[model samples]
Target chain A: MELSLFDVVGPVMIGPSSSHTAGAARLARVARQIAGDFVRVSFGLHGSFAKTGWGHGTDRALVAGALGLTERDERLRDSFEMAKAAGLEYDFYTADLDVPHENAVKMTFFSADGGRLDVVGASLGGGRIVITRIGEYPAEVTADAPTLVIVQKDRKGMVSQVSQILAAHDINIGVMRLSRTARGEVACCVIETDGELPDGVLGEVRSVPGVLSARSVSV
Target chain B: MYSCFADVERLCAERGIEPVQLFVENEMRLTGRTEREVYDRMDARLTIMEDAANRALSGPLGSVGGLIDGLAQAQWRYAQGARTLCGAFLNRVMARALSCSEVNASMGRICAAPTAGSCGILPAVLLTMQEQYALPRRSVLDALLTASGFGAVVMKNATVAGAEGGCQAECGVAGAMAAAAAVQLRGGSLAQMLSAFSLVLVNCMGLVCDPVAGLVQVPCAQRNASQAVGALLAADMALSGQLFPIPADQVVEAMARVGRQLPIELKETAQGGIAATRRGREIAREILHRERA
Candidate 1:
């Protein structure tokens, strides 16, 4: 590797833990976009993050962020109180997992209109976050644009059918991951196709009898 | 914004931007404080750390903790000694009063790339390098600019949440950012800077976000201490003419991948690692129960 002075010291930021607090705020904000308003949030902490969520203020930061707060927002402490003040409810819990990450959080957010989303996200060091799960499905998709998360039945040709529609529009799938429930009765296909999913594509896919629900994420 | 270390150097050559000028502007943007304020904060924080180390050293403690205390004292003294060469390194102590004390008191501040509890690592390293290298403050400023850009990329690319990616994203990234700056300070080329970053990322990858008792006071401080050493070592590797096999992009991507594989408990939930303990959890419950009562 070629050496440069910039590589040694790059940026300045807040501290204690960047990935846990900053990334959690961003994750909660993203979750808010999908979860919508008038919802409840329940956060489950794993490993070290779980043990010190309150002390590290990870839980408060997440809740504040879910309510639309940024890392620099002075109201974050109040943001937690504001949730209840705004009639928003939330809870916190802890779970154990045999994993390498010492910092992990599983957040379940509920929307008022019967929309429920569960996001399992991890804060890698350096204030970075990855959303690994949405609900029971493997929604570990990238935040890149033109992505579609389709909750559909576990049936043959379903993926190809969706691909065909996307292909017809000249849309390319950058990354795709599919997972099914343990019972195998339901499955989800999350396609991070490039350049928008096309307006009618989502409606048409939803129209499919086997398709349960579909959502789009813009990077 | 800084795709490669070359970009930073190129900008310097093309725009005649000195490192100190760039450093000042970038410092203001990143910390919401002026260059003078940052200088003051740096001095104050280093002083505080030194005092803490001296106090800890005066007493008989475990070898590891004692060694850290002594090292910390030395780092502060080093910064203090270089104050003349790095005149900007000294400042009023009050400038660094914790901005998010509530978060730290009740929960804890997320010091983007620093230990939320310590919240002074990046600045500490930056100021120290400026003083130690006796480089033009302008050059240091430019390095700071490049570093902020790198930080933004990390914030966009991976994550900064310990709960999500663990302390790796926090202090790990901070160290990497600092390593990049250090390489630049040593007048290493772009390739060297990126190599330094690769070394920093690979070494600190997947560091968990377990804060004992949820307080940023304990392991958080220790983590910052280690992070400083890591940053220096990574920079030294690149400055010493050693090369990293992996590219910066690949290293960052691998970090993201590793973060994904880590269980939620380890990320920052305080559930799995240091957070989950017969004593730690009991303390948490007791605190919460006390709050309720």
Candidate 2:
């Protein structure tokens, strides 16, 4: 809880609402990372995000975020037209996530190659967001700092191997969570770091044995 | 986890400096940023706040909901030639507060000083204080740093989210934050800053978050303007040796408790207060339908 002054005073952003707009955009950005390239995406709104999201521009903000725009980007208001021009199709619907968080959304991203990614996140107000679930891998990623998400075979020592590589780069791991659907099947390791893993760290993590994909995203 | 007002006081005492120094050190230590980096970022935010206010004052009528369109500029017109009520300085405060609030409603870029709903309060107070006192930008940024410390404390001990703690948490905290910032800019002591903080909370406690139709228009804009004035007045009280009977920390605790006790209808649910009125319901429906179309 070492809150920065920026947390209390800033995040210079465009908004009708921070939770509904800026937080929505951050959630979408994280989801897009897990989602890969997509042609169509359906946003499953939950709780308050569905009820009053329209007025807050949650839909447009999410689209703009998925298109890879930062929260402060001036293009956020014109996101709908930009999405259409980019040939990206999207829809919004109320979804029953059965989660208690008042502001949540689940996204289903469908790539042209038939690959699909499902991500669930909650907008925790004041432009803060957390990616709660990514394709059945329960994890927490706030994107407050450099975050590395590694999908790999849930073999023993995978965590240590990833940690060793990061340690090699002198990047301190702030918080890490490992979630697997089954024993030795598949796992997602969400490593939140203090300093960013220097360039080429993602490629190194991807090349590690048993690792499927690795991606780094930051706010 | 330097979370509360006590932490700030401790840091200031340990370092033998003021809240401004504490702000810079805390931010640097918290984010691993350099001193220059920290000031540059704060300076950028101040620029945005000023820019938002300027745009709203000079741009065309731009509120998305048309509720607060041209409000800041309109006040400027009203301030001219005998329509002046509270003198030019106070009028400027209200106008500037509306300017930033209207900027927010129109989807213009602005710094969320704690949150967007209460964004106008600090800028209005600090900018107006600068205009009156002839303070430079550096002094204003210092005040902003001081205000951020106050905000960080309230955020830690209580809540700043309207949905969680009502408008008392949002506007109330903003006023308190602005009061302390105003005191800092005017060179008030730490004790005086604390007194001003308590004054704001004691005065504006238990305010409901009943934004009409759940939009940050209507009372939200009005509250920003009023809260700015309230903060400045509180600063004056602290400067004049007026003190709050209760301490600032206790006032924050009471504010949080009162917010929790408020009915859900009054807490941005849009099901009560002004949001529950017939016109409020109609406005909600109209906004929803218009967006759908």
Enumerate the candidates' DockQ scores in order.
Answer: 0.10, 0.63
How far residue A118's Cα lies from its native spot in candidate 2, in Å, is 0.8
In model 2, where do residues sit more than 4 Å from their true spots?
Answer: B1-16
Model 1 chain B: which ten-residue window has the lowest total lDDT? B92-101
In model 2, the clashing pairs are: none
Identify the candidate with maximal DockQ: 2
Q: Model 1: runs farther than 4 Å from truth?
A: A1-16, A30-38, A68-75, A96-102, A111-121, A130-133, A142-146, A164-171, A182-185, A194-201, B1-111, B114-119, B124-141, B145-214, B218-293
lDDT per residue (tens digit) for residues B163-217 in model 2? 8888889988989999999988878988899999889888888888988777888
Whole-model Cα lDDT per candidate?
A: 0.61, 0.86
Worst 10 residues of 2 chain B by lDDT: B57-66
lDDT by residue for model 1 over A1-219, one digit each (tens)? 122222223112222345556556766766665554546888888875775455445776788778877654546656767998888898888876443566777778777787667777776654556667777765675454556878888988888888888888889988888998898988978787758666788887788779888777654
What's model 2's lDDT at B256? 93
- Per-residue lDDT for A98 in model 2? 60
